[model samples]
Target: MRNSLRFKVALFFSVLTIALLLAQALGVRALAEAQEERLIAALIRDDMTNVLKGYQANPALLPPFDVRMNGYVSGADRESVALPATVRNLPFGTHEIIIDEREIHVAIAPMGTAGTARLYRVYDFNIYEKHFKEVINALMGGTGIFALLTIWLSFGLSGLLVRQVAGLARQVKTLRLGESAPIQPGKYDETELAGLVEAFNDYHQRMAGMIAREKAFTGNVSHELRTPLTTIKTSCELLEQDAAIRGKSRARLQQIERAADNMRELANALLMLAREDSACEVEPVAMAKMIETALTPFADRLAQKGLQTTIDIDGDLHVMANRPALAIVLSNLVDNAVRHTDRGGLHFRYAEGWLSIEDTGPGIPAHAIPHVFDRFYQAGSPDASPAGVGIGLSIVRKLCERYGWPIEIGSEPGQGTRVSLRLPAASRT
Candidate 1:
């Protein structure tokens, strides 16, 4: 959740709001405190000036004494108006000092006709300071509450900000390979968001055009190749009927026929892959019968290599699947086993909807196992012998994926290889 865009946006807003609010609170507090201090200091200075002038004009006139204000002059009834030691040493200026554990602001000025004696005017500001602090505390408390409210509002605002983006993502998820319609840019109100949707629509149209071209190319090529393949098969059949074609000549002719059949199957498989959906008809296929038919193509190769073969599938075992797709899968698996295994045998077994092919070939390398199903990926160095252009397993994987079948391959360096397919079970015929 922390990695989500909404979460990140909310966090960004939260940090920004906190910083702005804290700065605002501090700035207001400092400004208010400075203004109050300046006003209080000016009042003290004015009171001191008035008292000094009155005593200067009339030597007998005494300074006013009040609860919030008091005046005292040095060398004039010094014993009766006792001054604090801290106040007596003060120069002619305004000063703040503690008197009897209370805060006092004092303004000292010159007094007497000779301008030698100092006059001190004291103002006790403890009560006013207490009230000022109370007001500041309430302001700070309100600011704190407002800050929390702003943080909550930030989450809601962030969600609104990204709602269109989230909706775009949901639309993208619903898109199919080539069948989905483009998102309408007019749906979004923001210019940037509308532009983004337009860009996506352009990209989607380009991809769909490419897919259409590829499908057309594959369909045409497959259709065109079938003609030559059919002609070759028919010619081979006519040549085989003639008794003059014997021994090596007859065997070569058979090879040509087999090659033509394999070519046709390959073209069909490629055509099927190019289409968005399979065109092959689905039916209940007898597992053992399909295995026997698939082994026919590689029978000569197995005999040439002197390798054995075994089948342990029940005659009645059947699976619900597309026949041609399953045929291509089994043909590829058997062909791979035959190509690799030169010494030992091949085993085929079926149980609980899983059909497995076990080969005694020198097993695939552990590091290469993961990539065996990738298109055009072969084990060993480039200088080594090639392995059928490496599309056999890739085709099988694609077919299995298209049909929602589960397939797996397991092998060790020299312990042989095993490929398994879990098919949909059907009632025995």
Candidate 2:
């Protein structure tokens, strides 16, 4: 809750409002107290004047007056009046005193000739203190109510703003080329928010259009290339059957056949990748058979390099995957292994739900391992053999990701490299 924007805004507003209210309350209380003191002083002065005039007219009228007021004749030693020493020494003017926890306002004046007697009017301020307490209580109560209202308003407004931002974030997160609709500007009232929505919508549309165009281009190109690739493969097969062909011509024809077959496989893989839909059907495939099919195109090169290959899997062991995509993945791994290994062999192992391909090639550098699966990212030294473009592992990674297979690569310098893929348990079952 503390991390929430709404909570922070509300807390800030509440604190600011409470501080302002407290300051205003103190200022108002001070002003009221000052005005009340002046009013009390004026009333006390007028009442004292009246009492002095009454006493001069008739001395008997001074003893019994308003009970809230106490009159004292200084120098007469009136012991029943209960005046404090501070009030007794005060010069002839209005002053304040506290006696027995009760605040009193005192007014003094000359009562007779040549300082013979002095008149004192004392007014108890306990009633005024009670009233002041009531006022303070009311002010505090109102301040609390206003503070609560301010907090509620701040939270409500901040929540509305945060929700709008969250909505925008959710839209962006779920945005996909053909799956999500573009954001509508009219949904937002604020000018800046509307502008942002419109801008995102424009960018989204452009990106979706570009993707569609690229997919169509790739599909069309792959379709066009397949015809010639099949024709070339057929021609190579026919030429290899001819008895007139010599050793060099036959080898060249065989190379052409392998190249055409590789191109066809690559085209099929690219076509599969370019399609956005992932509704391809998966079926049980024998692990050994899949490995054998992948290794066929590289058999001549592997043999020429004097490299032995091993497949360690029970013939009954199988996995479930889309045939073409999985074939592309395996073929790419095998091709990379054959191209890079100078004199060592290839090994494939399948156990439970894990498949591993280890190659005795100069291992990938530590720095290059992280980027090995990036498109067109070649590993190893700069002087390494340029047998294949760097997309082989990238294709392998993509296929693994699409099928929800986890892949890991480990390598050590001059020791070789190992690639492991963990398929779903359901695939093995």
Candidate 3:
């Protein structure tokens, strides 16, 4: 029963009431007894002296038989106590007697002859006893009623306080992490509880800001994709209008084919971003060995452009990654580096779980650096003579982000550029 708050509160107040009532009861009993004793002593002593003085002044006015003066005495059964041989009357030393058939304290003394000059002192406690009993009954009843009222109020007040706290806690439990919830106000005083409620409202507003940013990121990507798609569709329609399949005009058809391929590649890159949870199968690939294999396809182009290639690859550095993803990312970076370099030389390094592509090329401009990662955003205009879609960095960014690897881009315009890839160091189970 003590586990419940109402029971505990009620018990506490009940115990407090009992203690106060007990102290009051003891004080009342002692005070009533003392006051009665003092009152009885004063009345009995004064009467004993006065009656003895009256008897001393008149000696012949006494009765022969022993009797109570001016009043008849009675026993406990409301009958008369037999008069003794001597009138052991009032004013005697403290003793017992019958008065009105009730036994009571009495004292007697004589001032003149044996029968005359008598006096009495009486301390009958009957009246005080009756008065004390009535007071006891009234006090016990009043104290009991007060104790009951206090217990009821304690349970009601404490239960109300506990109920409000429990309700607020249940509501807080329903709130979700990273998601905002509507605040339902609970019963509370205009105190510390108000501050806590305002804090929750502030947190809900901050969550709204994060939700808005995620929405904007998605909207921007969709707007960027629309432009390149329209350009590819128009170029394809232009090629289909002509019927000649031979001569220098064939390059027009080839250009259309290349644009279509580029658009398909860009679409696939966007698909990769959309499906980040798509799992890919993997196997070991030696860095120095795979770069040698991949660079073979671009050799002819390098030769035609009167360019030189330098490969300074260390021993076989094994890395685990999806072959297709690594091929697209590495090929795109290398191709872009080679295309933009006027010196026509490509350099490579494979060291410490990383592969770097460095080219002796006129590097990217400084002002365009920040926007390089934006989709379909190419750096340098026709004046600096840079080519290709601006999405190579976007692909690299998405692939590196999805794979949880690190990518670094560093360039000095008119000097050279370096693109570094750091693969995740695999953990052993």
Q: How many clashing residue pairs, candidate 3? A: 18
What tens-digit string does per-residue lDDT give for candidate 1 at 1-429?
248788789889888887888898889889999999998987776766676777778867765432222335433222333346657666778787876677666677765566665566656677888998888898889888988887898889989999999998899899876676789988888899999999988888898899889978887897689999999999998998999999999988988997797788778778777776574567899999999999987888899899898999888888999988999999989988898888888999988778999999889988899999999998756797885778888989999988888999999877889999998779644
Task: Give RMSD (Å) of candidate 2 vs. truth.
Answer: 6.9
Candidate 3 per-residue lDDT, tens place, 117-149, comes to 444334456766787778878887887787778
Ranking by TM-score: 2, 1, 3
Model 3 — which ten-residue stretch has the worst lDDT? 70-79
The order by descending lDDT is 1, 2, 3
| Candidate 2, residue 350: lDDT | 82
Q: What C-alpha lDDT, on a 0 to 100 scale, does residue 157 get in candidate 3? A: 75
Score candidate 1 by TM-score against the native: 0.63
What C-alpha lDDT, on a 0 to 100 scale, does residue 252 get in candidate 2? 84
Q: Report the C-alpha lDDT of model 2 over 33-57, residue by residue, as the tens digit.
A: 8988778777776777777887889
Higher-scoring candidate on TM-score, 1 or 2: 2
User: If scored against the real structure, what TM-score would every candidate get?
Assistant: 0.63, 0.64, 0.41
Global lDDT of each candidate: 0.82, 0.78, 0.66
- Number of the predicted model whose lDDT against the real structure is largest: 1
lDDT of 1 at 48: 64
- lDDT of model 1 at position 285: 90
